[model samples]
Target: MSGAHGRRERPPAPEPLPAPTVDAHTHLDACGCEDAADVVAAMDRAAAVGVTRAVTIADDLAAARWAVQAAHWDERVTAAVALHPTRTAAVPEEWFAEIERLAGDPRVVAVGETGLDYYWDHSPPAAQQEWFRRHIDLAKRIGKPLMIHDRDAHEDVLRILREEGPPETVVFHCFSGDAAMARECAAAGYVLSFAGPVTFRNARDLQEAAVVVPEEQLLVETDAPFLTPHPHRGRANEPYCLPWTVRGLAALRGVTDERLATSARRNAERIFGLADVPPAAHPWTGGTDGARSA
Candidate 1:
């Protein structure tokens, strides 16, 4: 059904998982959420369906600030701050300083959604690389996981990570590589976060790669407000829809949904330092769908 202003409504929520997991990457701000209450409702929606924890990511300076605030708004939410590659065309030195400041916050768990994006020509390649290096350094300095967003620039992203000496915990968010690339990343001790696209019928290569990834290195995400999973591909995505991706991945890997979800949750907790976070109350009566359009 259409929402207000004739926007496409979100798909109905998938069934809750047998075990809880974390959305390693998402953007609550992009989901049209703007305040603490909105963030809480979104978290509750996700929590209701066993996505008990989440790490919302920032794609630009404004988002970086918003992410940290969102983290504070809900204990279930954590933040990853960065200036996205596509937005690096004209970034000033001060912007990096601000990102550094945000990264220092206790609420910020990772430094990223950073790396190369060759798909969009919005930013010059040189500038994207320059800032990518800066974010890498910041992640290393802060002793946090480095979350990377590698679009059509896989070679360069890998090369730079090798050259710079990646952080102890590196993650390729929404990993888009095939089996060969997945092996390379796994061998390097980097985590591969698979988002909704893995469930698409045309994504045989991704499914193949997902099978090759070690259970400990695998993670699942919604990339909410985008990349809605199969059977709901064209609709607005939200965290509650994450179970579809998890179930699809579990089937591909020939594991029980509980086992896959457990491993993914452990990997996220270990990487993002969420090991100490207490579980949110599981009030199953809430809307299975995520926060609705206002």
Candidate 2:
């Protein structure tokens, strides 16, 4: 019924808490939801299941701004800003300045979700290469890590990163390559972030990749609202379900869930520049002298 000024009043509720699991990477700007309310609801659902910190990424200028704002809404959320490789053609030259400006913000931690995607080829190869190099330059200049999105173009991506864009910390998110490639990436000092695909029955190669990657170089992510792990297959994935992926990795690596989880957390914090994380509170610091439990 209409109340004062003919308006319907809403009931009060308690403030929502953050998730427990740490979602290493997610595309908050591309969640395909309507408005900020939808985004918060999605985050709440993730938190309910134990997912905690999330690194929400933005693939372009507008999305970058939205990501920054979203991070402001929750202390548990951080942001990564850069142009997606596929959208390189759409990114104007002047937008680089805006990216640079955003990259300087404290909330913006990494400089990507940018790299090569030969599978789709949404943007011209040359243009993608140029933009990718520019992003690397900016990351290097600002001393931030680079979050790479390489899909079916591993060789090219590796070559470019090795030649012109050697970021201090390079993270290959949703890594789908094989064991050899994983070894090479690890040897190159790049962090390999595994997603739900690693738990797929048919993803033996990806499983192998997870096994060979050293604990220090391994990180786990949901890539959520997408890439839901096995049992939850075909469903809209959320960060809260990362434990499934972590469990899968644990099995493949011959380590306990707590052990793998701790290592992954430490690796994420190290690569993501989350040094402010307290030593005792860090999951990997539970036992021993900085060595992760196997």
TM-score of 1: 0.92
| Candidate number with greatest lDDT | 1
Q: Lowest summed-lDDT stretch of 10 residues in model 1?
A: 279-288
lDDT of each: 0.87, 0.75
Best by TM-score: 1
User: What is residue 119's positional error in candidate 1, in angstroms?
Assistant: 0.4
Across 1-294, the per-residue lDDT of candidate 2 in tens digits comes to 002211212112212222234678986544543344545665666666556577888777777777766665555667898999988977766788988998887777799889988889689999899899998999999988899999889999999988994978999999989999999999999999999999999998989989999888888888865787877776656566677887888899998877877777767777776655222122221233322111
Clashes of each: 0, 9
Pairs clashing in candidate 1?
none
- lDDT at residue 278 of model 1 (Cα atoms): 42
